[model samples]
Target: MGMVLVSHSQARVRTHDKCAPLLPLPMMLQRNVLSDSAPILLSILLLFQNLTISSNQSDGSDGEVLLKFKASLDNPAALDTWAGPTAPCSGWKGVLCGQGRVWGLQLEGMGLHGAIDVETLAQLPGLRSLSFKNNDFEGALPNLTRHRSLKTVYLSNNKFSGEISDWAFSGMNSLKKLHLENNKFSGTIPATLTTAPRLIELALQDNVFEGEIPNFEQEGLKNFNVSNNRLVGQIPRSLSRLDASSFSGNDDLCGEPLEACPANYDGPTKYDYHDDRIRHHKFPETTIAVVAILLGAALIALLGVCIFLICRKKKSHQETAPAATAAAAAAPATEDLNQMERGGESAAPGGSEGGKPSVRLLTFLKEDSEKFDMQELLRASAEVLGGGVFGSTYKAGLNGKKMVVKRFKHMNQVSKEEFNEHMRRLGRMSHRNVQPIVAFYYKKEEKLLVTAFAENVSLAARLHGNQMSDHQSLDWTTRLKIVKGVAKGLLYLHNELPSLTPAHGHLKASNVLLDAAFTPLLTDYGLIPIINKEQAEESMVAYKSPEYKETGKLTKKTDVWCFGYLILEILTRKDSGVEQQADVDLATWVETAVANESSGYVAGAAVFDQEMAGGRHSQVEMMKLLRIGLSCCEADVEKRPEMKDVAEKVEEIKEREFDDDFYSSYASESDMLSSRGLSEDFRSINI
Candidate 1:
């Protein structure tokens, strides 16, 4: 089953460490007076002395239990990180722990299959949460009632077939959320849901459950979705308050949120409003009587509305001018790149491909750039580099210069004057770490921004590209240089866009364009004010901040979180896609890989990218940066360091010089490389 989210509430296990410490001073003073009590004191000391040792051994057992579970999987590579000696409570993926004991396992989207050994799981004493979402689990589930402490169970988006027995959840008294969506469960929603008093969220959508929904009476069941099932009959009164969509896709299910359920049926077989005589009309006689009067009154009202509309026509047009310019300016403002896909340019001056209107020469921000008008742009040969939620980007060869044209929609939240003012502010930005806005064209509906074409690929390509190419994997020093540049660029944006929600609303590895020298240039900065706020939240990286999800607000620390994600991606040579088979949220994955609370140290060949390994000194510096990255990715915005402080932290990680022979032994010969936005590729042969 595919799960969207998972959480675990944990109560710390009171480890037996609180046994009376060896307070020898107190005993020494009382030794002479309490000499007669020596036998009792010796027994007490021995009992406590053995208790701590047993607690340590128990903690280690949790790892053994998880390793056995991993061994049972059909594809063990999914749990490769679980193979190491790292304690399950310390750093193993999907293993959640608190107070040095495992309490939960979040194994969603791990591409897992095979029998889930319920007996093995019962070995865990306090395990409270289990999310097996988006896996390949098939056939009947094991007797989960054996482990009754389970609280949140997510088994959504799986191939598990057959009806769930009513006794499946029989003793899960602590259960709070149960999701079985996108499966083949039949018969009916488990009747045992009513037994769990604390149940709050239940999702049974997209399943084969039938025979009417169970009457769920839990007052705390605030979230329930049973849509797209074989449910029939009236929705239970207890669930009538749920949204209409929750009952959609069930053709037979009807009531309050849907149409009234046939009004007890057989009330009337047929009716006809087209009948000429009132007797032929199946509707009431009074309804026919009022029809003539209503039509007369409606005619008189229509005459009044026409006169009123005529009087207000002049003022209405005046008011609408600011909301929109000439409609002929075109609504398809994001097709400049699509023109290239058609195999040739539109001969029309303003790119007739999308009906874009011809304006004068565009506003140029740089003093030395050769100014070109709409006519020249329409004639240039262009190729689309990329397209996303904002719009399409085109790499155009215009007047012998390589230029990148970026088209954007949904920038009309502000008036034309204010939009131009924001563009001007962006143009004034002049840092090497920041992508310069060379020119811009603004309309009431959309915008076109231009900049110098980047000769190298984006950081995302360098990091994730699967093609065989020289310098596919980066070295330590090069990665350090890219992230340091990123930090500095972020600091500059924070200073410049002090009023913005997030200084760079779309900061991501793909958004960071690297120059030939592998220098990071932050793109798409400070547009939160102009972009449609709803779309930005859905599509931009800034809203990925944990606080935004919890509070529906954005802050400068959102940029910090994005930067932290980039740092972790660089260190792990991984992407940040949440559902990618080979990757997870880089920050969360890193935290799990090295959460060594017992030792306060995470150093092994597994923690860093094996290809990026330099001398041991390099690992020390990488550790410092990793710590800083984790700090930036903190869930609490207040805990995240200020962007200024983060910049200083990055700058302080000095990559010191080592002896020539020692450096050559561990470091790559190609120390410098062309920038790929996600990773910089330095080819030794080219150097």
Candidate 2:
């Protein structure tokens, strides 16, 4: 039920391909035999069965392996897209198909907290590569011998445990590269792994493997690392070509890479042996037991007392360490403190035993809760709001006050000091659309951040087809207001604030919440550092500026690009259809589409044709925005526009209006927009 990717080769099928004839007739027949809901259920089950059967019937498919993958996680209903037209493999979420078969399965950071179904994945005889990086998958990796065609396997940064078995990878003879880094794997490296004749790279670093390092004699093994483990014994001369840093962390290791093994110490047999016999007689067993019991009891009591005293001292220090200052000046410092503390918690370095790092919990008191819990707020409107990239949200009433209660999925990666400092900063901020932290509850593993609930839904929700209402259609005026509101929020993040802190690296339509007046309020305004990587990935995947991948740093320029994308979302009335592009090669499509749009060939094309199509957004305006977006999505971080310039250009376009004349003659008719780059939008007369 988790993330199970299966490959089945058919007569070739494209992204826009239609479904085969056999699958739908059963649904047609079921209409008479089952009730309304029953038919839906039956259809879902039938579709899964057909997919299983079809996959099994294939010469290259391994059904049992696929079944094991399906059993390793929660429901994988998100992957079921087989029915009316497109088969699931062609357009399913987290699937990549090429030449009528599943080529890769990249479910990286999908909040998929379950064990991997290695068996299921191995069934796809044609799978060239697979990656489940930065997820919450646990347990030992499954055997994958049948998938001899796999070129790469990236299972890094997971919770996978157990010793690396010889059979675990002995079957994958064709694997060119393997990444098992940053896991809890132990035991000695299997000598059989060295037998992979075609393996080019093997990364088994950042684990708990011990014992001697094996000499992987394969000449083709160009990149191999067994670093940061308890490995001992001498390194063979065959691996002398590798950098010494690769074998640095281990202590007991010796030889040329390290030093010569310690000389075998021979006892001074004649004198020492005679002196040992003259030593005092051994103590009685009863005396030893009595003394040991007394010492153990004393140590336990002393440890308890020390812990109690430490807690008391810590609590006392917190109370007297300076009272809360006014929100403006002190808020930035508080936010900074939170950031530093959170960063420390996240980067938990070594010193752990048993392969498990230690974790600390957080808690907040009710009596110490903030004053904004006004009841009338929720009384007027109370609804069960859903969860976001960070956590769940709910509409509430606080003494006639309406507010939003955001229940964050807390992790051991944040400390109490960080949470307190960040909350203080959030409390000081007072913006209309920007949700303020009204109250918070942090206890043990549970943490709840309460904010004033807004009247309107997220821009993404509004843009979604099923959720859009006639009256809610954002006309030109409302769209302008939305743009301005978002711009101002971003402006505050980039420049208006005393501290030049960038909004947690992402700003998509979903993060932009609307008030009753349709004013945009940026949520998660000051809570980025408190988020875990998995949670951050959920929020960032769509809105992430391209520079993030290269530098791994969040900057104001990144926010500007995100803001530009949000503007494009508003103008086009599209909810970043990033998730929908799971079937196609998104990187290729975006690049090609952006290029075509830039050159004016696809500039004012209808919404249906281009990915960013919709009558709500002006083609000329959308094209202009796309130009900005392409620049923002540029690989070079320094080349992107700043927020101030972005806001000004957007304001200018709104005033000038994007009409026919605006679309036709702005640039050359080349296949790609001239990489002419970005400039200041300082035209005195708007556009």
Candidate 3:
């Protein structure tokens, strides 16, 4: 007799006559139909014929399993794709087929109902995974021990009830992930789960399981949860390594990660009190009466003293009323004289001065300018720089040093603590491109932030301000440098300050100032958390991103959108006109220009600043930047590139420009040397 081995691909079979004695008798009999004994040979032939027939009908068996499973569904409408032929491998929804047989079925959230036909499904010899999660399936989970091929099973978010006995997962050595959460299963979680040596993830949350949690700590296990159960006793020491969230809602569960169990306490117990051991005592009535009379006399004397003090305070106020009025009237004149000597205008009436409690200036930075206090800040020569949605900014000069003070208008909602916290966080940030806050003053009625004055000008002024004869128009190199600096600054804010939501929520050209060397300095960073939403919207309306109206929340993506507009403003040297009656947004205008140029109807140079275009600049490079800007302003927030990515791309562009210039210079030098050599050769030939 010969032996036959079936290959994994069931389509192939091989026979080895020499190995006949090595195989079992039944296997040998089945493979060798021409055995020495006629009876044995005949029996083996009959069995082989039956196996051939079964192999040919296995697809039909799989189709039957699918049809039965579909029938068990309460809502046929949910399985619309399960209609037509029962050829699951070809057209069935959620059916995965391999090696000419069904291997996986996922019917998640398909409105399935009734118990799954585990016995019928087990008939599919190749089925390896099953998912019925997020459905209406109910009833006790059937025995899955027969389905040894299953590797993953998800039965979560259902109404499967009853105790999952120790034998439920018996012999399932190949199972890897099992999700049984959000069910009605009760009783202790079976310690038998440790039998599955390959099991990795087990989720049993939101069940009615009680009793002490079983210790099934296996080296291969990675994720496990039994939260929202009635389990008692200390958590297994091995399982304490998992997150506390995994064991939460289990009231009686205690130990290591959780509260330690009481040393002398067993589980819950009842106590009985004996009434026979009780005793009572009484005090003398005359002693209590004497104490009450003494207390009444003390209260009468205290009341008389309080009344006399009230009359004396009223008389004192009456005498001071006229004097206070005269002082209040004369205070304005003194304030004017002080303002004149300080080389600045008078502080606004009803400001942080005028009979208010003096506040101390809080400085987060350790700069020399921190020496000035609240009196110096109030007395500093002040002139209104401008007023925006948040409030007005003032250019204040104290002694010889100059600074800018931003006084918030409608920030009454922000408490003093929150304001100080925001200022401290901002001051801690140290970046070349970010403007540092020197000091801040917070009061109930007023809040002011002081920062060093940017000596050059703002990006807005450089681009759109009235160009004086002495002022040089920002060249292409300077503009590119400014954009790169702003992007790098934003990237720092985004990465270094994760706690600050919507990092640089109000980024705009006006907020970007230029230093003496024309380096871009970003101001007003991280102000969104403390400012009023309505005021933020009203002031930053011009730079409001596309998602602002829809989400009504500021996000880092919105800041990216504002950065995109800032790029457009710098390149086109035009404002978005959101603050005016102009209907065209800067981004929209640039997009239209790019579209026309891409269509070959207009030169790409049309979208660039005329001063830059008139100079030697790459129109191709300008178009590339325009494309980037458009991507940042995309209506979809998710599509916008992160600030880090933006910074990298801008850096690449900057490097490319340097390469172009280097190559241009090299070519010019080569031409000059060649001409000189030719002239020398001509002179030698003439001689």
Q: For residues 85-174, write the lDDT of model 3, one tens digit per residue.
A: 546766778898875588898988877887787888887889899998998888887789899779999999999998887668865768
Q: How well does candidate 1 score on lDDT at residue 339? A: 64
The window of 10 residues in a row where model 3 has the poorest summed lDDT is 662-671
RMSD of each: 23.1, 27.7, 24.2
Candidate achieving the largest TM-score: 3
lDDT of each: 0.71, 0.58, 0.69
Cα miss at 255, model 1 (Å)? Answer: 44
Query: Candidate 2: misplaced stretches above 4 Å?
Result: 1-382, 468-471, 496-501, 538-544, 577-602, 605-623, 655-687
In model 1, how large is the Cα lDDT of residue 522? Answer: 87
C-alpha positional error of residue 685 in candidate 2 after TM-score superposition, expressed in Å? 13
How many clashes does each candidate structure show, in the order listed?
Answer: 16, 26, 1
Off by over 4 Å in 3: 1-322, 325-360, 367-369, 467-471, 541-543, 578-582, 598-603, 614-617, 655-687
Name the candidate, 1 or 3, with the larger TM-score value: 3
